[model samples]
Target: MNIKELPFEHVTVKALDIFNGYEISFVIENQTFHFLIGKSEELLPLNIKHYFKNQEHCNICQKMIFPTPFGQQPCLPLQKDMKDLLSHLRKTYVVLT
Candidate 1:
């Protein structure tokens, strides 16, 4: 499903620790959905926006330097971090119509 199709009205993000991880929460149709991200040891100089930007590439460096099973791909840490959250929401929280 397209993320744009989700009924999200607003989003809130909070830093987790000095390691530069974050917790992202979404407000969808008045209900709250949340997810946590751990620090990336591979990516140096972590930034908060990395957890929020909506793009296939890293918003900070604008480079496709991150490694993945697919090969060195565009940095999509936010997308990767949301994987479990999206699945959990799809299975238990989000009400599809």
Candidate 2:
């Protein structure tokens, strides 16, 4: 399925497995949808307007750091709508929960 065609307004990372890939859940008009993104597909460059912050937690330093993108990060600037959606998701699902 094309990620761009997804009708979700908000999305959260439910789970991430190295073997199984990403388990993403999203909400659209109060309805929630769940889908799995394969490992190979997960690394693909997404055709979305979003800044690719390839930041990961540093175990030793305990700080968020941007990693070198080895063809694994999306490189684009986020549009207003995408930013709004991300903000909503962060506020409702990530920060709150």
Candidate 3:
């Protein structure tokens, strides 16, 4: 499941404080489901791994970035997309389930 290949009709990404990661919530097969992933953690998914592996990491000294595995810092556009997803989720995330 490549992160980029996920046909996210609707999705939400929230940063997790206790674990220092993020939770991805979305609907699939008519069921609401969630997946958790952490930065610099062993449990990082293969999808994220594969996705980041194919991307170009930030080489410049000063720039907003989304850090990936092995000290790779990709730019912040991907992070921005995640924020947009969160906003979309909030519009429908009324129940605190």
Candidate scoring better on lDDT of 2 and 3: 3
lDDT of 3 by residue, 13-89 (tens): 77778876666656433333344455573334211211222233332223332323443432233343444444344
Q: Candidates' TM-scores?
A: 0.39, 0.31, 0.36
Q: Report the number of clashing residue pairs per model.
A: 0, 1, 0
As for lDDT, the candidate ahead, 1 or 3, is 1
Compare the candidates by lDDT and give the number of the best one: 1
Worst ten in a row by lDDT for model 3: 45-54
RMSD score of candidate 1 (Å): 13.2
Superposed Cα deviation of residue 72, candidate 1 (Å):
35
Clashing pairs for model 3 are none
The whole-model C-alpha lDDT of candidate 2 against the native structure comes to 0.40
Tens-digit per-residue lDDT, 1-97, candidate 1: 3554556555655676665665556654443334545556532222122222222443323554323333223234434445644445446544322
Predictions: Cα RMSD each? 13.2, 14.9, 11.4
The digit string of per-residue lDDT tens for model 2 on 1-97 reads 2224435556667546555454445554443333334446333212231122455543222344454443222222222234444444455555322
The residue-level lDDT of candidate 3 at 65 comes to 29
Alpha-carbon lDDT, every model: 0.44, 0.40, 0.41
